[model samples]
Target: MSKVTQHEATGLDDLDPATAPARDAVHFRRIVAARQQVSDAEDGLREAVQAAREAGDSWTIIGAAMDTTRQAAHERFGRAR
Candidate 1:
């Protein structure tokens, strides 16, 4: 996938109010959809980790699935007291 430049990412909200509405509408829609996909992926990852813990899975196993160190996984997703 092509990378979004800092200008494109940060200047999305700086569009002119009097310009063509269709142009801004398309750009806004694309940004919203991209953000939604990210949110969904984060939710899915959290649910998967919770399910793993409930299944008595070890941090090492979960880390392997996520391609990270065991301690990293625990630090990232472990329950807080």
Candidate 2:
């Protein structure tokens, strides 16, 4: 039995330039899907932050969790409401 690597599992390593149009379409679709996923995750994070604040979590704690300063966290997320 042959071993299948991670690249083969994702089909990205199999893209051929000879099929440039089809390959480009597939890549574009993947990019769109990835962007949607990121947007969804950001929305979830915003909601979680709101809930955390309601539960008495501080900017200092949220900033630490995000690897940023308290002021930075506040600047990025505080105005969402």
Candidate 3:
């Protein structure tokens, strides 16, 4: 079975598991690990945004911290707060 690099596999659907059981196992494991990392980061961001709101930080400040517009930050994380 051939190994699929990041450029080769556009997504998990391109991971032909049946043809490469061992490699697929490793790829699937790594995919889960990467996904967990992303999920954790997202949760952390949400928590931080909520905390900032509770601390009276305006959307403008949060937006600057996120390198985005004030409206964008408020639109994305305000509801969570």
TM-score of each model, paired residue for residue: 0.67, 0.69, 0.69
lDDT of 2 by residue, 1-81 (tens): 999997898897877878845534788789979999999999998998888889999999999988999999999899956
Question: Would you list the C-alpha lDDT of every candidate in the order shown?
Answer: 0.88, 0.88, 0.87
Candidate 3: tens digits of C-alpha lDDT, residues 1-81: 999886567675665768856544688689989999999999999999999999999999999999999999999987734
Cα lDDT tens digits, model 1, 42-75, are 9899999999999999999999999999999999
Show model 1 residue runs off by greater than 4 Å.
1-22
Quality of model 3 by C-alpha lDDT: 0.87
Ranking by TM-score: 3, 2, 1
Model 1 TM-score on a 0 to 1 scale: 0.67
Candidate 3 displacement at residue 24 in angstroms: 4.7
Candidate 2: residue 42 lDDT (0-100)? 96
TM-score, structure 3 vs. true: 0.69
In model 3, what lDDT does residue 6 have? 69
Ranking of candidates on lDDT, top first: 1, 2, 3
lDDT of 2: 0.88
Q: Specify the poorest-scoring 10-residue window by lDDT in model 3.
A: 15-24
